[model samples]
Target: MTLFRESFATQQSLPPWEARGVQSWCFLFPLSATAIQRYLDEYFNFAHPEPAPFRFSALAEAQFGCLTISYYPVIASTNKANMLRYGPQTTSWDHLSYNEMYVAAPVLCNRVTPDNLLVDRQIVWIQPVVMCDNSSVVFATREIVGIDTMHATINLRPGRAPGSLHVDTQFSGFKTFSPTTAEGPLPFLHLETGSPLPGGLPEAATREDKAFLEGLFGVIGGVDLVGGVRPTTTRLISLKQFRDAYDLRLATYQAIVASTATHTDVSDLRFFDPKEVDLDFMWSASAEQILSSFLQLGRPGDEKASAPHEGPGWDLVGRQVKIKVAFAYTNNAVYDQIETLHTFGAE
Candidate 1:
């Protein structure tokens, strides 16, 4: 069993008040410490490099990004009004929720001008992609968008990689089998799970109270610092494989909502797609990056993607490329565990 109380609840960001706006905030999963560590050592290390700046690492901290950052208020009588600018307004666990795993950075700001000019004193946080049983099965791949909450029209982060920009991402998907289990099926891509998130899945999750299980792990936790998430893609799943996974997920979701009152239709169906075949696009995150490269694995117009074999598939591309898996984080050493029976879901 895993401990899911306060120990898993609240954790402080290390080296607080980073001027560059980069702080290593904790991701408290309900999983066990050992399981997390093993995944980090055996699985993740195999896929990415250790502290590799460009591939998987924490968001690179810039020089003097913030004029000042503070976790506590200091008494500055002469500059009393600006005290809030130097300190964190709230360090309590209110940013957390029982419905989903917490994924947020320590970001706060203060005014610089008298009209209370808010310069970079703004912050943006992309809420975690919580799992939900009520989630409708979306055909789209999983995506993590970081919006500029501070500025009305300015929150997209671009990268040197292909496709779009400003997508500060960390991979977080669930495994089908328990790491503690002797050995079972390889874990499938399972990102959402729980009683139901606050608003429920992303299209997000939630509820008044009750507990559920969920796993939140990222593939490229630090792809931001270098080459912009070289998004080392690897999973080579087929259409049939994806459909099977989708079926199981749909069934699980229906069952959850069935127990609730009049769910009518799938108005509350979870929307994100967390399957192997869905993402893996080269342009995508690891999941997306995988597909883009894998597509090159076969010739063009090949209806289905198959490794090199005498099959009626893409006539242009040739060969079978296998994708590998190992969870990687931007920051190398800091790892944690979540202990729980909660399935990847929402409240």
Candidate 2:
């Protein structure tokens, strides 16, 4: 929300920091890397508390401008993935990581601002992820996130498409929590000022972005969005992908609760799901494409909106797109999770 630029943008980057603030607005202290390691390993693995408190050292708060709202420590990766849904089969996938924070707040920057304009007044921070056709990953040291004490499953009835003959879905889901264990700190990426994106933030807002920021407000207030951290993005899974993955995550969660509760089948049970497969996709883009292809008028997929000067598929593809749509989910209970964490119908 705030725009910041500074005199010393060129000398802004801190030596070591990665704690990212989502709409949460979290920032890190200038601790030694050794101390930071201890914090991450020993003391930082939980959600934030009510009022969505700001986490910052006095110096950090002064430097970054806004008090951070919330942060993701050790963010493995933050980017968007989108799958085009078309064709008779309606066979496609889309997952946008509303999980990554938009670094709208101020901090260090690599470049100095124009003297007359402002230094560190504001710098957009962008994650220049590889093209949608490509992606990369970061593997951090794996650690066990804590388990909850109670969980409840809700059954969802199916529905039919309006004026049509397509089956919707039927499935089950649950949310568990350990209310006793309060939240802890997180370390995120402190991208400098003057990066890119409007007002020097990272990615632009999409549907998932709206869901995440709104849900985050509730979570920080101690309501437990889904008995856990709400998912950071939204998803569009095929009906089959929904049924199949929901079954898997539920099964995995069931086994986890069973073992944590009684430890009776700890040996017999195991977690099984493919990693490295696509589960989520966001709709973000690089600076060039965002400008070049974005339609100044009309809907994205509308052929009539395509100008003759533009080439093939130009109107149908690119950023800032919206359309009238209808979607179905197994039910509303874990619908957000289906959008965020469920991993069926992966690419």
Candidate 3:
């Protein structure tokens, strides 16, 4: 019958990933695909329009503002000199890596109906283009290339049409009837085999068969067999009808305000804010410890950090600490942006 029923019947066991995929497909299958596709096309088209400055008052006024930043994590170098001198505690002395970043554009869909459903539905389809080094000189060059990830946030307000009401009623009753056959009064009489009694026909046949025929055509209580006419001794039917009408009106109004939304972002594109908006005693203490460590044993420069020192007792730690902190702050800002877009509306 339905795809859901067919899937349920045919599919036996499913892996977690497969199961989730199936469920997602099932959920989206009923929706208009053309509508969704068009929505996506418009969403990206609107987002990628000539980069112009945009501002949201609510976000700008907030403590975090619209600013987001991120830092790429430092990868330990395989160089022997680096391992001997800094090892795990090298800080800025370690090789630096950077994460990719992007600014987010907000898209709003208002007063959306079934006809307007596609307008907000397309964000789910937008995907990020994947990138990787392919040069022969690089050791880790070849990698899968396609859409790597995306970040999306959606707010929905679902609504329904006006003045629509639905109602249903059920009736169950039993009636008595007689038969003319010699085997008379059986629940199911064989119409062809049953013989008619003498004197034109039996009384049972006359009365019971007549009643059965009349009932079959819906003629009860001497009213027209097809037309409905109920005998009433009260004057409340009009009020009941009014109540049903009001309920329908209320339901339609309520339906207009319902909605669904989703937010998602890819990991590679994740970014965070580097600056600390609020600083407490703990953060100050941590900063002091870091600065103290840097001043006590910091490298003079990147060259010294990368190269071997000749002095009998020379320590190059300060320069490496500064480099590490810079990288850390950058990555932190990038990660903050990612988190903001991910949980942007949560706060």
Candidate 3: TM-score?
Answer: 0.16
> What is the number of residue pairs that collide in model 2?
43
The TM-score ranking, best first, is 1, 2, 3
1 or 3, which is superior by TM-score? 1
Q: How accurate is candidate 2 locally (lDDT)?
A: 0.20
lDDT of each: 0.20, 0.20, 0.19
Model 3 lDDT-worst window of ten? 20-29
What tens digits encode model 1's per-residue C-alpha lDDT throughout 1-347?
78423232122221111111111111121222333233223311222222211111112221000001011111111212122344544432212111111222211222244453545433211121222111111111111011101100111222233321221112232222346534211111212111222332231133311121111213223433232221222111011111136556442321000000010111122211112111111121222322232123222353443222232211112222221111111211111111111122223
- Which tens-of-lDDT digit does each residue in 1-347 have in candidate 2? 56333233222221111222212212211112232222222212112221111111112222111111121222221111111112223422222221222111121222223443324322111111111111111111000111111111111122132221111111111111245533221111111111111221123246754444343333223533233222222221111111136555432221100001000111111111111111111111212231222212222344243221233222222222221111111111111111111222223
Worst 10 residues of 2 by lDDT: 254-263
Stretches of model 2 off by over 4 angstroms after superposition: 1-216, 222-301, 304-347
Of 2 and 3, the candidate ahead on lDDT is 2
What C-alpha RMSD separates each model from the true structure?
24.2, 26.0, 38.9
TM-scores, all models, native as reference: 0.16, 0.16, 0.16
Candidate 1, residue 285: lDDT: 21
